[model samples]
Target: MNRLFVMMAVLLAGMSAYAQSEKRIYTKAERKSAEERKFQKRMETVMDSINYADAVKALEELDFVLEADRLVFKRGETAFVTSNTNFISLSDDNAVVQIAPFNGGGPNGVGGITVEGRASNIKMKTDKKGNITFSMSVMGAGISATVDLSLPKGTNRASVTVNPNLNSNRITLGGYLLPKERSSVFKGTSF
Candidate 1:
């Protein structure tokens, strides 16, 4: 019985020593690197909460154009615009603008019909902080759309809000706007 007790005590001691030795000890440099990584992660989180107006100010300071050749949506199809004229054309069936003229007399008016050509007006405005507001009116189709964008400095990503004067639905589309150089890459390709 005495010998058995001695063996048990020795075994327990050995196990305790083994467990203590298993603990990892980091070097000073390794500890510093870990701390730096944690600090960087925190900084990124704080940066994401920055105000949009401030971000637009930074873009303005950099003299950046908020308009892109292509406006890519997160859920819907992408829209491509001409660089010089901003003329956009989609397929015949899925065209954004549709026009029809009414000729018959209604409760309000006359039998004469007025026809207007397919003319569109575009107005673009930018604030001092580089935030952009674009409005398009298709007089022939009686369609009006306005887009407000908040752009960050040195980044292609933007927060966009689109309001169409059809019914009363406003859509929030958050996505990246491809730069001029990257726009060419997607020009011929179907995304």
Candidate 2:
């Protein structure tokens, strides 16, 4: 009876040891790769579920106003609202531009600075992923600016690059171009 008891105890101990050893230790790289694979799979599923045709149609019908948040200049970044009150409204045919200091705010902000322009010679293209690219010449106030804008489908965000003929520096702005319904509440509100 003692021998039988000892054999059973040995078997249980061995089984416990084997169970503990079954756990595998993963390296940091291996874990990261596994996470990346999971992320890719999730992205793939999301991409597949999206209706590309609908997205393209929505982008083609885009018409909204983009309010500038930040203005990137050669000197540095500045609060767009501080020295500028600018908004770009884009539709299928024309882009209406409104800028602050309507005169020409001289090189040092002494003159009557104008920021108004109208988009002409507009060219628009779209990619397979429903990203729209628009290039146009905005001419006004005896000055011209090349405006390049990108709008992604099914999103409220847009990116704009404005290269004015008078300045060597290019200004880039990013902001939301939400529908009129979404932007109305924020009208007359300042930050």
Candidate 3:
């Protein structure tokens, strides 16, 4: 009986030791990769703070690009598009609105129409909570439209609704607002 008890104790101790040894141990490369990811995340947080401030400044100056990666129509159809081909840009007294419903080749060489016009009736308002309402009428040779933009507080994301004077199809562009210098959007031919 004493021998059986001793054998059981020895077995339990050996099992416990084996279990501890099976713990996952990261290699040197994995440890370095984890530390690098942590550092990258911290850097992105700091950069986002600075970028947010710059976006606010650009909004005040009326010089920013709102790249519309998502397109929504009044008939309830929504599409996710590439930012390079679909964007609404405002610079001083001029506003350019482009919509490429499809990818690859078409009109404006980006599969859609690009309209640039002189912006008038520019009404920019900001409430106490930092929300913004910017509306303007864009009139050109053949384009007559009203562009209304809304930016919520504490974030650079924005939604712009474009209403054409002659059409019932309302289009809204949803995306982030970025400073002009930081904007990587490519502008196609405009009418």
Candidate 4:
């Protein structure tokens, strides 16, 4: 009778240990799954906020304005551009302003005859006129083109002057691009 009692006690102790180990394993898996679910929710919410059509429209209008001066644009062609992205977010008042450069390939099929011009001496500043001046000198194909864009509230004016080198081919650009909408895509959750 004494031997039976001792054996039963040992069995009960082993069962308790097994039960605790199983509970720990399940708790860890549940925690991991909950985290995964939270991440998925944030991702879906972000994907829904992008409006590509609005971005394309904005670029088209800006292009039309640039075109009035006879400057032609080609996708992956005529001119590649880089800009400092200034984001205005209402959620984070103290967020640091991000400066990002935009890279573009000018017209894809290049005839060495159609070398794309590069912008240098680029400057942008606001004046007392509540207007901003965007100025740059473009040089390529043995030619130089200088452009100054004066953007006033509700009005933007550009002064473009070109000097073509001897044997230089005239270049024109045409395209619809949505470079300004890059910020609309959310790559990850921001705190």
TM-score order of candidates, top first = 3, 2, 1, 4
lDDT of 1: 0.41
Greater-TM-score candidate between 2 and 3:
3
Q: Residue 159: error of model 3 in Å? A: 0.6
Model 1 misses residue 119 by how many Å? 10
Which residue pairs does candidate 4 place in steric collision? 72-172, 72-173, 73-173, 73-174, 76-105, 76-106, 76-107, 76-108, 77-106, 77-107
- Candidates 2 and 3, the one with greater lDDT: 3
lDDT of 4 at 21: 81
- Indicate the worst ten consecutive residues by lDDT in candidate 2: 182-191
lDDT for each residue of candidate 1 in 1-191, tens digit (9 for 90 to 100)? 99999999999999999888866899999999999999998887666545344444433332222223443443666565433222122221121221111233432122211222232344446677654654434333433455455555434456555456565454444444432222221111111
Q: Which residue segments of model 2 deviate by more than 4 Å? A: 1-18, 21-62, 75-84, 91-114, 179-191
Per-residue lDDT of 1-191 in model 3, one digit per residue for the tens? 99999999999999999888856899999999999999999898777667667777887787999988899999979999998778988899888898998775766888888888998888889899878888999998657999899988666778999999998788999998898888998777776
lDDT of 2: 0.59
Candidate 3, pairs of clashing residues? none
What's the TM-score of every candidate structure? Answer: 0.33, 0.51, 0.73, 0.28
Query: Mind giving the per-residue lDDT tens digits that candidate 4 earns over 1-191?
Result: 99999999999999998887843445878989999999998875554333223332332233212322123232323343221221211111111111112222222221111223455665657678545454555555433555445444323223222334453333332212223333341111121
Candidate 2 RMSD to the real structure = 10.9
| Decoy 3 TM-score against native | 0.73
Note the Cα lDDT for every prediction shown.
0.41, 0.59, 0.86, 0.36
